[model samples]
Target: MRHAETVTFGGSALNRAAELRGDKADVLALNENSRSIALWRGKPLICGTNLDQLALLPVSQDLFSEADEPPVPPIFLGQSEDGSALFAHDISAWEPAALDTAAMQQFVDPTQQHHPALPDDHRFVELRGVMAQLSARDAELAATARSIFGWHRSHRFCSNCGAESRMAMSGWQRNCPTCKTSHFPRTDPVVIMLITRGNKVLMGRSPGWPDGMYSLLAGFVEPGETLEAAVRREVYEEAGIRVGAVSYLSSQPWPFPSSLMFGCAGEALNEDITVDPHEIEDALWISREDMLTVFSGQHPTMKPSRKGAIAHFLLRNWLADRLD
Candidate 1:
């Protein structure tokens, strides 16, 4: 795991200026040097001939001040390399006339939305489709925005008292007036294990995943459960394979809806997969030789894991014998 942080969405050491979160006067002073990234219904505004650059507009960009102020206020994402303030705004209020809701819910949204006021090349695209191509900084900013915005959207009503809460601490926290309670954004922990026995690794596909799409078996870490226990329990529960000697690998901030994925390595005691039909549609062990074929697009039935995901990162390292 020497190069653990090298994983996409893992390496950028962005200077998150948490000290300024509660400083109203200093936060106001940021207007002079702040830049904002935008998200429309979770898709970030990106513009590049190759579609690799994230759109970091001036905080006062005219489009942001349109008739409808962004329902979710701008979130302070911390500072950039040059010490300039960085923030993210969710302009989910903008309604696209030809939105493909179905496509949005699929494995990866292929459709891009363009705002009438913005240039045609400047479009909001799904992060999953372009994550591997983005620079480390862009990937971090985009992930941070999508996760916090999704939190605010779903947690508008206070969980403690059922009262509407207000955004606070530069969108890092929510305050409930009636209950006088403060809540912070929560990232659910998920354990995605690289379970292996001999030269083969365990791979599984969910019920509705696209044909031939498979990834390492994963499950949420239950409360009071350690990462090691979660790895063992999940593999057994989903694929009916007992695992032992779990070890940590790299991790990724997966923002499909806000999840911190713990990529771990595990030794499988048995490969007799009695797949829990409710947990996964199928699970099987693929040898190192066959996996390489999948990675090179030569396998006719099993597609490689998505490029930007932690599963792919772990598998790539494992194949290269770098999982030391």
Candidate 2:
């Protein structure tokens, strides 16, 4: 677990200036050197020929006028190099002439969007598609923006009193005037397990997943459920396997829809497979030797898990015996 934070989207030490969230004057003054990152429909605007650089647009750009998040001010991401501020703006309002809705809905959207107002090289690309290539800072900023913005979009109304809420605390909170209630962004906790028995590891594929796509078993932590309990219950519920000696290994911020994945190492008590059709389509144990083949893209029947995901991170480190 020493290298846990080295996982993708984990190492960035961005100074999220929470103290300034309530200080309007201090935040406004920082705008003198403030630059904002832009997102269009959850995708971050990245530049450079290799698309490894995050595009930091000027705070006073005219493009902000066209952004949909008007009443809700740009999210204050954090402090950047020197004394400048970094913010996130959502420009999902602008409609592209030939937007491919189908591509946008795909599990891994490969589409990119370019704004006429921005430079030719600066295009909004799906975060997951380019997450592995981005720097730690860039990855953190993009993931934060996507998660917070998605939360605001889906939870516009107050849960306490069914009244619409307004963005507050510089996008960190939402305040409902009618109910005088404050709501904060929510991150669902998920436990992804690396369940092993001897030289083999357990893997499963959910229904509708692309053929040959299999990953470590994972499930959301229900209310009042502990991490260890969640891992055990999920494995049994999904693949009918009993887990013992559950231990934390690592963690990752999975922002596909705002989730914090707790990676855990668990020992499987029994190897016999009994997959639940309601939870997963299939389950099986793959020998350590065969897992290496899957990782090397030589497995005849299985494809590699997404490289930037925590599943891939846990499996790769397990293979190299780095999960200390």
Candidate 2: where is the Cα deviation over 4 Å? 69-72
TM-scores for every candidate against the unseen true structure: 0.97, 0.97
lDDT against the true structure, each candidate: 0.90, 0.90
What RMSD value applies to candidate 2? 1.4
Task: Give the CA lDDT, 0 to 100, for residue 120 in model 1.
Answer: 77
Worst 10 residues of 2 by lDDT: 22-31
Q: Residues 1-324, candidate 2, lDDT per residue (tens digit)? A: 999998888899998988777566235535767888999888999999999999998878888876554524789888876858888888888788798889788878889898989889999999989999999999999999999999999999999999999988888999999989999999999999999999999999999888899999999999999999999999999998999999999999999899999999999999888989999999999999999999999999999999889999999999999999
Compared with the true structure, model 2 gives a TM-score of 0.97
User: For each candidate, how many residue pairs have backbone atoms clashing (under 3 Å)?
Assistant: 0, 1
Clashing pairs in 1: none
